[model samples]
Structures are given as structure tokens and as C-alpha cells.
Target: MTRRTSTSIGFVAVLLWALLALFTVGTAPVPPFLLNALTFALGGALGVSWVTATGGWHKLHAVPLRVYLFGTIGLFGYHALYFSALRLAPPAEASLIAYLWPLLIVLFSGLLPGERLGPLHILGACIAFSGAALIVAPGPDGFTGGIGLILAGLCALTWSGYSVLSRRLGAIPTESVAVFCLATAVLSLPAHLIFETTYWPAAPAGWLAIVGLGLGPVGLAFYVWDIGMKNGDIQLLGASSYAAPLFSTLILIVAGLADPRPSLLLAAALIAGGAGLAALGSARAQRRLIK
Candidate 1:
């Protein structure tokens, strides 16, 4: 696919992720690891079905074992750190810290071979981060330093690293994400058994939310993201990722789960402006390549 097409596909992941908080809230009382196992199992099943229908089973065999390990670690490690961070630290602060992956993705992409990081990309990422901060930053309960904060930072690093490194593995088929999801599910089941109390979703809405998470955010999102990171405009994707938190908050407000705030308007403007700048930078780079 063309770079533009792949980037658009990648942005779909960002849009899907916006619903993460909403769906997660619906899966209430189901502890994190248990939720992870359930959702990932569904996600893996979704991928397996797609692979079977497409007759792409041969591609899966070609992927190296190390790649599977890498993918599994990326998916499992990120959630493990993120869940632990939230449990130990205040949710707001931990979320803000963990959300640094987008900014880090932009920064880390600069080091990748054949990728150019223009000033606009850096500026846009920073501005977008500020917008995300407005949404996820601490409330009346201010920052308190702890190991959770440290884990949150690592959470950001782990995800950003996973995303950027995926670009180097462009030869790997997107279908390989199926294995990643399944392995994550397997790993999470044991973790849940060890550390979390087993609780099923009490209501149909909760079960629906888990299914939604598996099919959209955790399933198709990862597949498209792999294609995008491998072939699309990484810088633009990185900058645009800030919209996840912005759109997520809007979803909560629309669902009557959160009170509408004036800050959201300003945050929206900043994120839009930043994404615009990043797009302009990508356009410039493309034009340069054409010349």
C-alpha cells in the first residue's frame, strides 16, 4: 500500500483506542489481568479467523520465534506495567505519565534509518503532548513520587520502543500480530490467577464492552498499526496519537460518564493544530522525495 494509505490505516488504530476507556469502564470489577486475558483471547480469535479466511496461514509460519517473543513482550509488558502503575499510583498521574508513548514514538523514530525528523515534527509532538496532559494530568490529588511513577515511565518507553522497532520488522506480515495477542492472553491468564481475583462481567453491557475491546481496540488496531508503522508516516502517526486521550474524554462526556469541561475545547484545538503541523511536515518530506 502507499504510505498515505498505510498512515490512514494506522490512524484508525488511534480512533479505535479512543473508545478504550469507555469500554474498560464497562468491564468493571473484572480485574486487569483477567480482563486482559479475556479481551486478548477474543482478539486472537478474531485474527485467527481473518487469517483462515484470507488463507494467510503460511505467512505465520515464516515469522521467526524471536519476533513472536518480541511481539508478546511488547503487548504483555506494556499492560503489566500500565496496570501496576495505576494500582500503585494515583490513576490520573499514572495515566499522564504512561501516555508519553506518542511523544516518545516521534522522538525515537528520528533515530530510525531513512526517517527524517523535521522541526515541525518535534514541535508538533510537544504541543500534542501538552494537549494530552490537559486531559490526563492529575486533578486535586497532585503528584506523589513512587515506584508506580517509575513503572509508568517504563510503560511509555516499552510501547514507544515496540512501535518504533516494528518499522524495522516491516517484512513481518501484519497477521503475526495474531500470535502476539494469543501469547499475551496466555501470559495474562496465569498472571490473573496469581495476582487478581476472578470476576466475570456481571451485565451484558460489560460482556459487550469486552467484545468491543477485543474486536476493535485490541484486535484490528494492532494489525493496522503494524502496517502503518512498517510503511506509513511514523512522525505523523506519532503526533496524531495524542488524539486518543482527547477523543477518549469526549466519548466519556458523551456517555455521561464525565462532566464536560472548558479545558477540553482548548485541548482539542491544540491537538488539532499539532496534528496539522505534523501533517505539513510529512507532506514536505514526501515532496522532497518526489523531487
Candidate 2:
């Protein structure tokens, strides 16, 4: 595929993750470990099947050990901390904090060779942070869980580090996602056995959410995201990623899991506007450089 096409597909891939968060809302009855175990396990199976069908299985063994190791750390670490945070903090607040990874990406990307942090990038990131803060800041009832907030921050740090590393490792064939997913499953399963009770989702909706998470976010989403962060307009992706939380929060409201509030609308506007300005600036800079 052309670079543009690949990058466009990557944007779609990131957007799919928003849906993953949405589905998790419906699967609340499933314990965090069990929920993650099922999602990653099924997702691993699908990734393997896809790789096998595509004739990439032969190359899997050739993937560097570091790739597998780092992928496992990045993928497993983010979810583990994120899920744990959800149990302790309000999901909405926890998610807003976890979503800090995107802005972190914007800030961290500048440290990479050849990436620039222009005025618009900084402005956009600040705006997005403000929007998230607005969502996360407690109303009359202040946030009670300090540990949860810390976990969420760690989740952001872990995820941002992963994203930057993914760009460096983007040269690895995307099929290696099969390896990553399987590793996550192998790791998570034991954790579930050791610390958490293993139970399957009993309700149809819960099962559907698990299947959706496996297929979309945990499975194919990673495949697309790997390609995108490696080759796509990553700055644009990072700037736009602020929308994921907005979308997730909106989905929770629609699902009746979260109460509707004015902050939601304001947060959406700030995030959307900031992302728009950043993306527009990036496009302009690209045009100027091309000229």
C-alpha cells in the first residue's frame, strides 16, 4: 500500500480502540484479569490465524527476541495497570488520566530524530491536557483514590513509551503482532490463575464484548496501529488521539454507565478543536517543506 493509504488505515485502527473501551463498559461483570485474559487469548488466536493464512508464519521465528519482549511489556503493562486503575478509581476519571499517553507522545516524539515540535503542537497538547483535566477533576466529591491516579499515570507513561518504541520497531513486519498477542496471552493467563478467579462471561452481551475486544482492539487494532505509528503522520495521530477518551466517555453516557454532564460537551470541543489545529498546522508545515 502507498504510505498515505497505510497511514489513513492507521488512523482508522486507532479509532477502533475507542470502541474497545466502549465494549469494556458492557463487560463489567467479568473480572479484570479474566476479561483481559479472554480478550488477549482470543485475539492471539486470531492474529496467529491471520499470520498463518497470509504466509507470514515462517518469518515469525526470525523476529528479534527484543521485539517480542518489548511488545509483551508494552501491551501487557498498559492493560494491567489500566484495568487495575478502573477498579479503584471512577472509570471516567481513570480513563481521562490514562489517555494522557497521546499528549505524552506529542511531547516525546520531539526527542526522536527528525521529529519537530512546533508552536501548534505545544498549544494543541496543552489544550488537550486541559480538556482531560476538566473531565478528571472531581466535582463536589473529590477523587478518593490516590493509588488509582498513580496507576493511571503509570499506564500513560508505559503506553507512551510503547508508542515511541513502536515507531523505532516499526521496521519489524506487522505480522509480528501475532507473536505479541500470543505472548500477552501466555503472560496474562498465569497471572489470572495465580491471583484472580478464572470465570467465563455468562451473559451474551459480555461474550459479545469480549469477542469484539479480541477482534478489533486487541487484535487487528494493534496491527494497524503498528503500521500507522511507524509510517503514518504520527503527530496528527497523537493530536487526534485525544478524541478516544471523548468518544469513550460519550459511549459510557449513552450506555447509562456514566451520567451526562456539561463537562463532556466542553471537553469534546476543546479536544476536537485542539486536534484540528494541530493537524492543520502539520499539514501546512508539510506543504511548506514540500514546496
lDDT of 2 at 279: 75
RMSD, one per candidate, in order: 2.8, 1.9
Cα lDDT of model 1 by residue, 183-271, tens digit: 99999999999998888889999999989989998889998888889999898788778777567766777887655667655666676
Compared with the true structure, what per-residue lDDT tens digits does model 2 show for residues 74-181?
A: 888888888778767767667777877878887888888878888988888778778867766776777564688789889989988898878887668888887788
Note the Cα lDDT for every prediction shown. 0.81, 0.78
Distance from true location, Cα of 193 in model 1, Å: 0.8
Task: Give the CA lDDT, 0 to 100, for residue 264 in model 2.
Answer: 62
Off by over 4 Å in 1: 83-97, 132-141, 144-153, 263-272
Top TM-score hit: 2
State the local distance difference test value for candidate 2.
0.78
User: Model 2: clashing residue pairs?
Assistant: none
